[model samples]
Target chain A: MISSLKIVEAAENSGIDQNIILKFILNEWVVPLNKKELTLDEEDIERIKLIRELGEEFGVNDEAIPIILHLIDQLNHLHLSFKNNYCH
Target chain B: MKNPYKILGVKETASLDEIKKAYRTLAKKHHPDLNPSNKTNEAKFKEISHAYDQIGTNEARTKFDQGEPGEENSKQQWSSFYNTQQNAGRYANSYADQFGDDEFFENLFHGAHQKRRAQNQDINYLMDLTLEEAVLGVEKVITLANGKNLKVKIPPGITSGTKLRFAGHGLTENSGPPGNAYIMINVLPKAGYIVQGHDIETELPISFMEALLGAEIEVPTLYGSVNLQIPPNVSTGSKLRIKGKGIITNTDVGSQIVKIKVVLPKKSDPELLKAIKSWNGKYDYNPRGEK
Candidate 1:
């Protein structure tokens, strides 16, 4: 787990705005490991990075972010299901 | 309403299996989640989803084929049909939760920012990675289009189609903040290795003598070379699995599968020919089992 400060630093290194990161956290787009302590895991960091990408790179609005993420989650689930069926 | 078959890119005479395959393919292609911020693709996705809902199953297809109603009366008929078949609850829930919201469509189509401020355009940056680099994450400095150098960290076990985003590194406008930069990872194919999921398959060429007489040979892996033991009398195309030598991901580790290919000497020596003739005379071996 990483602290919120570390997330901010990583975001800054990636040229993302600190405010945007905070907003994502508040919006539950980037869920923290601990709400009080505000910690994040690698998965959370990756998700935040994806959300940042969608907003900055794809110009996706805040309202559309959740919908898009949900769809992606579903797609990933489908892929995993397919892989599980054939791999083992 | 558009024809269900046409929307899914299938013929009316297509079988249920064909329709299902078509729906899955089209859904993956135009899924709003995969192609975010693209209204046209989102609309297409919605259309496909609706068409699938109309004729996905046998009963649904039968009803649709019977000509339930035209475009004018489809709205009421679809609602009633959806209400009657509770089994379609899965699709209904997803559609209603995601695309059925009026606010979502408004935001997607005609949000306040649509007319007021132009969002920054996204920048796509392509990055090539070797198999080793992909297996083990690497950090490198990348120069953006705006002449700014930024250090990027690539995660381990990244495969093709993995997109990493660098926030606020995209085009900037006077109206709002800068856009994001996406790093699309393309893992170059290795000559000897073929990656299947987390596992790696490679061909190991061995001499015929080595196959007949067991030998330990060095096999190449993602990290380095390791010695692998070959059993005596092993046939060509035999697979040897080396545990925990394939891909390393956050959750699981894969193995390396080495396929053995027995190769004979290019030129035949006189001594070898004479020895082979004597051996053949001593013992008649019918490899083909025809006798």
Candidate 2:
């Protein structure tokens, strides 16, 4: 479980607002975490990090991020098509 | 792991407003979007994003104040990181040395940079593959039109129009970072086996005798040979779907489809011809009419 403080830390680390983090959670952008004391999971954290990077790299508005995030989630659920390292 | 304040080059006691101002300033400065073909500056941009992300918020600031590890935030920072290598070779540009390596790191250590990556252009290319190579997962030495040889590992289960990204391997890395080389998979049609999605389609010719009497025929697949059971009284054209016997998916599941054709002999034996003629001048049989 990712501690609440760490969630805040993650926000600070990415230089994004807490609202953005909360928005990710509200939109189900990241993986579902154990609902214990409002803690996010490791996978969720990684996804959030990637989202932040995309926003930074693409100059994408945080509001527009959900589209890509949704697309990625859809693709992941459908199944990975890219064959790279660690792919069987 | 350093202090977020120091990373973004902001003061520890800086107000939230000041922190935000500092963040935007640094983001606009060292940002991969703004930096021109400099990996070092790109790295610094990451650091700036990392720092701002850590200390820019109240919760994160409080956590940093209390000495708690903001692992999620670190990961979040990474998300914002660009593979400058794939961003049109910006990371590979020789101009990064304008500020010198030491000066670049010093500025990052000081939290002064901007977002320049998104402005840097990216490149993409289409790649072609053979059915045999795609099925067997061959090692492809692809030579681009511009005369660059790239060794690519062709994975099994790849479909036509699939795209692959090779980091730092495009035509040019103009400014921010080297862009990725995109390999758009074009699987050429095979001679006998027709590919459709994850399933393989094939047509096999069976003699009328074999179709009427029912027979087991050997059909060639990518993996090898499999015996197909032809049902008795099978029609001229029939399609059979084989479950889990087709091409491999990226996840390694198999699927297949088979089409069969019943062929008749061009010439018949005298006895057989006589027998057919006796039945032919015409038997009142219309399988398609009012049946």
Model 1 CA lDDT for position A86: 43
Task: Report backbone clashes per prediction.
Answer: 2, 56
Best by TM-score, which number? 1
Candidate 2 Cα RMSD (Å) = 21.6
**DockQ of structure 1:** 0.04
| lDDT per residue as tens, model 1, B202-226 | 9999998899998999998986899
Q: How displaced is residue B270 in candidate 2, in Å?
A: 1.6
Please state the CAPRI-style docking class of candidate 2.
incorrect
The regions of model 2 sitting more than 4 angstroms off are A1-88, B1-123, B144-148, B171-176, B250-254, B277-286, B289-291
**lDDT tens readout by residue for model 2, B1-291:** 446788767778889999889888887887766767643455457777767767778987787788665556545444332222123222222233444444554565689887766333445666677786776566778885458898886655556776676666754545666666778888888788877766888888899888879898887777677888888877766877666566653222445677778888898789988987898777876678944
Listed in order, the DockQ scores are: 0.04, 0.05
Question: Could you give the DockQ of candidate 2?
Answer: 0.05
- The TM-score between candidate 1 and the true structure equals 0.47
Q: List the residue pairs that clash in candidate 1.
A: A56-B180, A57-B180
lDDT for each residue of candidate 1 in A1-88, tens digit (9 for 90 to 100): 2223455554543334454455566545565666686765544555655665565445775446767866755444443433444458
